[model samples]
Target: MKRRFLPVAVAITASTALLLTGCGSSGGDDDSLGKAKGTGGGGEDASAPASPSPKPAGIKRPEVKLPKSFQVEFAGWTNSDPKLQAIMDDGKERLLASYAAIIKGDPQHSALAYYSEGDALRTGTAWVKGFSDRDLTLIGKGRVYQPQPRISPDGSGTLFYCVDEGKGSTKDTKTGKVTATPAGDAFVLYRTKLRKTDEGVWKTTMVQTERRACK
Candidate 1:
């Protein structure tokens, strides 16, 4: 997590962010999702039955668009399962809007509406507060690359994506001085778990983030 791209309390230290196992891979080109287990190994048990998947909830994921101000490019999402595809498609918009809201420093922004009442909401509030407290604003463009959707046997879905902030920057509010540049040895990776609400909205339940650097 680079300093310029992070919002106050949401900022992760670079040392811990760089701990990802491999730094050589671009984190792109891998569309494989988690695999399901099957019965019968070398010597299988005859009495066992395979686990059944949950029925589709018929929920519709909402559509999201990036703000014209931020030049964020997404690698796109992929999922072979129809139900899970709907879930991922909707989740991606909320995810992007979350980032956009942070960049704009607007707590009341519509993007903030996507976050539920957990870490996601807390982090979103912190981002807006950081800008207001420091009298600063973000001034840069970034990109994100995420893998296909991976749904659990119980129906929860996990999405892993990388954020490249090397091209962005931040500046002071009053002095108008360039305080921070986005480029550095660091980038960010996020792992978010989402579950549909009873109201049929796909909300993020938990988010795990790690900052990594280019080798």
Candidate 2:
């Protein structure tokens, strides 16, 4: 998904420092998604539990949680090949980690660092910061579907997916006012680069997004 800024009354001088539109991008680091830096502080929510589903062996997974106000749905996440499936799983987790950071108002969330790195990390950090800077948080639901995973002989990987933000919106962290996003701004396509670490973690290294690329 590409970066989509909140529709708040406040004017954003930088277009790249924003939140996920329907699609996810590499935050706002690249021209496609725009750029910004993330800020704030917090830790994993103790009430939330780690995903109960089995993950690839030897991979250290972080516990990701979203508040009751926010929800994300993933479609078609399975793959016949274990390696490719691992990529899909990690890719999903990375996106979740990003949202988790934003919701907790913490740009330095450990899960974000655990799931992403390099340009992807910088972009995500900026995106999360954009919200924290404005005292904004997300509410409602977003959907991620149609995952397409590819593996390179050199060992790097890529995952492409679609996001629907039509049902999502932003809420004021303090006043609790909610701003609705236009449906026209929903639906985005995202491409992400991944590399497996020695610890067997698939870290997102880069991300690109296209606006209105999907229905």
Candidate 3:
């Protein structure tokens, strides 16, 4: 997945949790899918259990104040911009498709949703590695303002955009600093590159952000 970049470094420490047969509290940081938080798990502090996965490491976080069905609506609809709008229904699904992992700051989730594959997960995370401030030059920050259906100079594929409505905040795993953050003022934006596939629907080839100067 491609993203807009801010000029900062954030250390994102995954809880290194594993979804064992037992049921834990499933906090935000707890990775219910893979490794454990402390031991043998390759995530963070293998020595002891972290309190709860706080927000992304370095970025600031906006309160969950969007309308109830935000992400779903975005994921489910294919309407054009301006004339069309994201509502409670499709908006919520859109968020679930991507932010399901975006909320956790996991690049794997982004890669799969946008690229329709897992190849880009590692690369996506690297863009935000060590991100520390709003001024940071990470992907997915500024491009949100650009129009949707963004096509390359050659006009090969389509691109889309969004604000921090669904993806949540990006954190520093090592230092716990949030890098890309959302404030409670207006809509955040992102640029997503896409293409139609044999499946007959537009597919995201890349997702990215362009950093902005907050007034």
Give the candidate number with the greatest TM-score: 2
Q: Against the true structure, candidate 2 has what lDDT?
A: 0.69
How do these models rank on TM-score, best leading?
2, 1, 3
After aligning candidate 2 to the native by TM-score, how far in Å is the CA of 214 from where it should be?
1.1
Query: CA lDDT, every prediction?
Result: 0.50, 0.69, 0.31
Q: State the lDDT at 149 in candidate 2.
A: 80
Q: 1-215 in candidate 3: lDDT tens per residue?
A: 23444322111211111111232324442222122122221122122311221232353323332223122222222334421222211222233333334334444443234434321234344432323222222223211222234334433343333332223344444655654444432243333334444433344433333222111
The better candidate by TM-score, 1 or 2, is 2
Instruction: Tell me the lDDT of model 1 at 56.
Output: 45
TM-scores of the candidates in the order shown: 0.63, 0.77, 0.34
> What lDDT score is found at residue 9 in candidate 1?
19
Global CA lDDT of candidate 3, please? Answer: 0.31
What is the model-wide C-alpha lDDT for candidate 1? 0.50
Q: Which structure is stronger by TM-score: 2 or 3?
A: 2
Error of 3 at 49 (Å): 37
Candidate 1 runs further than 4 Å off: 1-67, 179-182, 213-215
Per-residue alpha-carbon lDDT of candidate 1 for residues 84-161, written as tens digits (9 for 90 to 100)? 665665556665666566556576566556644465566556555556456666555665554445666666666665
